[model samples]
Target: MPTQDTVQRLYDSMDFQRAVQCYLWAIPIVGMESARQTLIDNAGARSGDLVLVTGYRDVSVMMGSNVTTPYVFAHFDLTDRPLVFEYPKGATAGSLIDWWDRPLTDVGAPAPDKGEGAVFVLVGPGQKVPDDLPAGARVLRSRTQRALLFTRGLDPDPEKVRAVFETAKIYPVGQTPDGGRTRLLRFKAEGRLTSMEHPHGFAYWQRLASALKGESVEDRDRFFAAMLQPLGLEFGKSFEPDARQRKILEKAAVVGEATAKAGAFRKRVPDMRYRDDSHWEYLIPQSYSNEQDVPGGTMFEERTAFFYEITGTSAAVLSKEPGSGSAYLAAYYDKTGAAFDGGKTYRLRVPSGVPAKLFWSVTLYETDTRGLIQNEQQIVDRTSRQDLKKNADGSIDIVMGPKAPEGLEQNWIPTRPGKSWFTYFRLFGPLEPYFERSWSLPDIEPQTS
Candidate 1:
């Protein structure tokens, strides 16, 4: 009954709405794609080689990563044959996540192997299981053909970290990676921009379309997948968006990413605030499950918010043991409820008796790339391991500004002017006080002359 003009307007609005929804739904997988591509493009990694990402400069290639340990990772294509991933026993832990960012399994201490070393046969969607599998090796399945293996050694010793890295092995199911059958592809710092956050513009859609080809349509994603077909993302087909679809998607990319930023940084979800008196919140941004799943369904909005800020998750990263896994707290705003301004000065108070069994660190990151903020001074973090100036009560007052504070240069992390920053407080092996909420951290406050 509607006129032609009314019909056209309705279609236009539908196209716009679908575009934004696509961005929200695809945020997690797109993040995984961006990371793999960055490893290939910027970190000099190929499909079958492991890339060791260590040190502050090279770790900057990640999105909201921890610098306390060295991470060695690789992307594998399981479409052809199931791959065998062998990990050595030591102070190492990791995870295997598919292109959708759903963790297939935790790989180290929290795993069935219990860090005593283990082998896994990784099978992908539509891939046939091999009959002659390695004895006692567990089989992990994925919904997509592409997956990444990220393992890190928890020891503080640099030489030990390197030694552990050399023990990993990855080979096709029919072969054994014995006697140097495979080698690790170490990442050397090039001081270039190797951001792993989701890409902007048409690159986002292009990556999403490619990822969908190898994915199995989940029951929940079926309707969303149909919506994408009209927006020029057809599984198994080359991406070719028409002029109209391109225009709609381009605008959606801007609005969708902008919306993601707001939801992630200024979370308003239930139980998002870490403490009643502080602006610092859980880095994962949800209390139900750090992995964002509940009894019946997933926390959709909460998952979207977190994947926009960081990629990959596992039981080890969210371990509930008293002195075992990691705990992360993030502060996106200052005490005045304002986003941090790099041009201004601020100070964070680390109280005495911090609740970390192993070590604790406070690292500042640029919001845009979610990487360590690059400064002329080449400093981005302050840790309990470092010999920083301690207060009379054994506390640490870490300062941040364009210029170092007089007499406090050792504890100051320089920030670049004309930028915004946030900080992550990581507790490696969080202790009882952290779980009991007995040790509450103070918020970062603006310094007044």
Candidate 2:
């Protein structure tokens, strides 16, 4: 058997090929155990530190404002595994539909009057949302709806919440609560600052490094127990974030290593492509810049989709001309016109080459909520492979407005009055120019004045 130190050296030196082999064969059991150890060594969490855990719907809130939020959380009382129904904060604007109110709603509410900075407790699966509350009291139904609970007093802002999610120590409590025994605890500002430096990443890496040092298993457990405090600080009421779930996430991250061999791997890989770093800008680094990739652009090779950040500095890096061997992926608009007048006829001209092995399409959607273009036709129109009017020179023109041209009825995409709209272009198969940035799509120019 390899000593922990030996294993550490091997893990650090393994090449891409060797890494794949190790991931496939060795990491499942021992690898996981070491990872848990690493998490413990790093996270120096105390027993009483608060934590929060949520499901997909709650996760979506971090993605975008328009997407529907899920309601999945069990408020857990740490002392006793009692569950409590923490209602999604907000007012009953219309019917059963609810809006989330944070530090705002907590004010002047009943007993748990968290001024602004408060940490909400995670209820376990054994608990149920209590119904026998006062008239104004509400309940969070499922994990698929948008819900909000902060540490009872620390008016946790959106930014802090995001950071916690990105790197918080987590433990897996193999079993879900049998009855409704979950609970939530509200934490105040005093709790937030107690251990500000021990974020999730710090704890994870520290623990990982320690495991490689050949520490005893009991020491690893002790470290793990220490890490659990911060992980539990952001608690989930229903179930403890168990070990198996963490393994799933670890394997998922390494899945990217396969992209090291882009060419041969492409053929063998399922849905392979690249992911440009631009997408993570506003979402990650907290800044959004006009991503321009001319000759020197970075590329991320993913299994499903690909991304390229283009910078058109000299001589228009992307081509606007038609029939070019470029993948005209998509054309999006924030609004139909400068200011929607409702009755005026607006037109958008998209200049792109449809370079595809199978087919191509241009789809129009209302930007309001992305549900669809709510109009009399009730149809989300598109120009797909089956139909597209090619120019004599071999290019295509897509029309989006109220009415279609005299001869271009088939290519017309309807629009709603006073509403904003956007468009998307999809290429069926892979193209070389798209990956290399040799060809480019024409800009969507507004025609109507």
Candidate 3:
């Protein structure tokens, strides 16, 4: 019964809803929580915003004023909401708990006559721990009530939730030592409160800096100008593809021209971070390169982890060979920088045989949060399993530095001015030592001054 325009709008709305739902489902697999936190950080949210953070067993809420300046928070019960304290005129909420060091007391709902009464305390955040708390030891305000709620499994108790809101206390767990436990309820003030965004909250300062300078709102166009922000997130130096990667993308301009549909494909993908030499793929590490290096493009899988090892003269060898169900490793070095008066050159010696059914590689990350080096032409200055160097004895010697070795120009990694450098190793099919306790990785030898 709707008009054509109205029907069109309804269909559009449905599409949007479906897209949002897809993104929500992809968060866990794609690590979207980290990105969501980053966005919330930029919005400049304040304390006392009813923060609600949860964990495996417990939930916590803190009064924002308790942690305003010098940033502190007041704790509270999970079942009962406490009253806000009257503040002085013209004064903002602040670390009131820190200033007063408020004494511990039963702040939840009151107990019934001839009922059991007890208290619970938590030592760590979100850990429902039952401790033999010292009597009269002065407990923190909300620690007891929050801990009790979980220890007694009262979280899902709708009756307790309803009772606490109305009468300020729920049924206690465990009986008191004497006769009948006098049911006591503690009332805490903090309910569902969120944390404050500050200098280091979530790249807020970065956004603010851009805004104050009248920069564009688009993230990619400001510092590193781009026509559009690359899909996904910028971690280290590379932009990792995100949920959009899973979304069915069409290349043709014609509407509904489904050239390619998303299919259920699964493979083991290694995390492109960290460098530990332990696995078999010593030939090369996973890395991104240019057209000259890898003209066939690159391959990646999902939900996979790789490993490697450093051995022999240096901690750069694999004790065991690799097996199936893994990826390949690659290594490459460029030696053009030695003529620039850069620092000394070093060599990596690997005597242990490379192992793995998939592949492996040893790559370079610029030291200090070693991110893949970003260059002008988009040619990643990294090596991989597809390319590498070999010594006369069939063993491998990797030359590293700002400048290339005399004859090992193809085996060089350029360094930033005077910054320290480290390496990352990737193994496609890391056998067993990754999870169990029996396997140990080789150490990385730093050429100490």
lDDT of each: 0.83, 0.31, 0.28
On a 0 to 100 scale, what is the lDDT of residue 297 in model 2? Answer: 34
Superposition TM-score, candidate 3 onto the true structure? 0.27
Clashes of each: 0, 80, 65
Model 3, global lDDT:
0.28
Winner by TM-score: 1
Clashing residue pairs, backbone N/CA/C < 3 A, model 1? none
Candidate 1 Cα outliers beyond 4 Å, as residue runs: 156-159, 178-180, 188-193, 285-293
TM-score of each: 0.95, 0.30, 0.27
Overlapping backbone residue pairs in candidate 3 total 65
Candidate 2 lDDT by residue in tens digits, 294-387: 2443111220111111101111112233332223342332233143332344443434554554455555544333223555664454544436
lDDT tens digits by residue: candidate 1, 243-354: 9899989999999999999888988787767788999888774364644457887777888888888878887777778788889999999999999999999999899999
Error of 1 at 78 (Å): 0.8
Q: Any runs in candidate 3 off by more than 4 Å, and if so which?
A: 1-344, 367-370, 374-384, 431-449
